[model samples]
Target: MPNIKSAIKRVKKNETLNAQNTKAKSAMRTAVKKADTAALNNDENAKELIKTAIQQVEKAASKGLIHKNAASRKKSQLMKKA
Candidate 1:
């Protein structure tokens, strides 16, 4: 609980931003996992899934949710698996 009005507003903003960040991160991880599984299963749609996963990783990195190097590593790993 924040006593000051500005502090209360800041807390609300922080909460919303945190939720958004969490959602984005979760989506990115899910996309990566889906791609990995598809690749391992030898699915025809694996290429498309890998592409989408790379895009999600790049988006997350651009948004500062993840580091650029980490995003690159994830992309590399996905491609390697595929």
Candidate 2:
């Protein structure tokens, strides 16, 4: 619905960014969930999963997808679960 050329371009850019952010956030959540479940199940690979989850959380935080404090809290929870 953007009649102006710049507005249309902005809309397109925003859509692309939103999609990327959604994907990153989803991946972060999935990684955290997997780590949590593995920890609860006493899986041998739980440590590795936790490591991966922490990395994902950090990545999200660095990208400004989540607050630094929130990332720290998530990392803490994952450690506790592990």
Candidate 3:
């Protein structure tokens, strides 16, 4: 409950950004899970899955949704698994 009008608007904008960031993080996690599963199962498409997952991680980092080091670490681990 912001008393000032500008504060109220800022709060609304923060909520919207939070929701969008949550969605992006969830999608990134799902992509990583899929890539890990594909790798563990020794699927022929594991390479492609890993590539997509890495791309998603990079995009999230670039958008400031996640940390750059975290993104690089995830990509490294996924590539190692592949």
Candidate 4:
């Protein structure tokens, strides 16, 4: 535990931010998985799913939750599968 009040506040803020980032990453992964499944099944919505997945991946990168190169790689792989 932090003895200083500012340090304590910072710890709490960090916990919150960590949770938010975890959630975002989870959502991004889920979106990518969905897109992959759609592509594998040859669903009509695969393209749309890829679009949304790419957007989510980009959003995560913009928020610094994931690396920019990783995000680009994901988008590239998704497009390739689509």
lDDT of each: 0.98, 0.98, 0.96, 0.97
lDDT of 2 by residue, 1-82 (tens): 7999999999999999999999999999999999999999999999999999999999999999999999999999999997
Ranking by TM-score: 2, 1, 4, 3
lDDT of 4 by residue, 17-54 (tens): 99999999999999999999999999999999999999
Residue range 1-82, candidate 3, lDDT tens digits: 9899999999999999999999999999999999999999999999999999999999999999889999999999999999
Question: Which 10 successive residues of model 4 have the least lDDT summed?
Answer: 16-25
Residue runs of model 1 more than 4 Å from their true location after superposition: none
CA RMSD for every model? 0.5, 0.5, 0.9, 0.7
- Given candidate 4, what's the lDDT at residue 1? 100
In candidate 1, list every pair of residues with a backbone clash. none
Candidate 2 positional error at 19, Å: 0.1
Error of 1 at 20 (Å): 0.4
Which pairs clash in model 2? none
Per-residue lDDT tens digits for candidate 1, residues 13-63, read: 999999999999999999999999999999999999999999999999999
Model 4 backbone overlap count: 0
Instruction: Give model 2's TM-score versus the native structure.
Output: 0.98
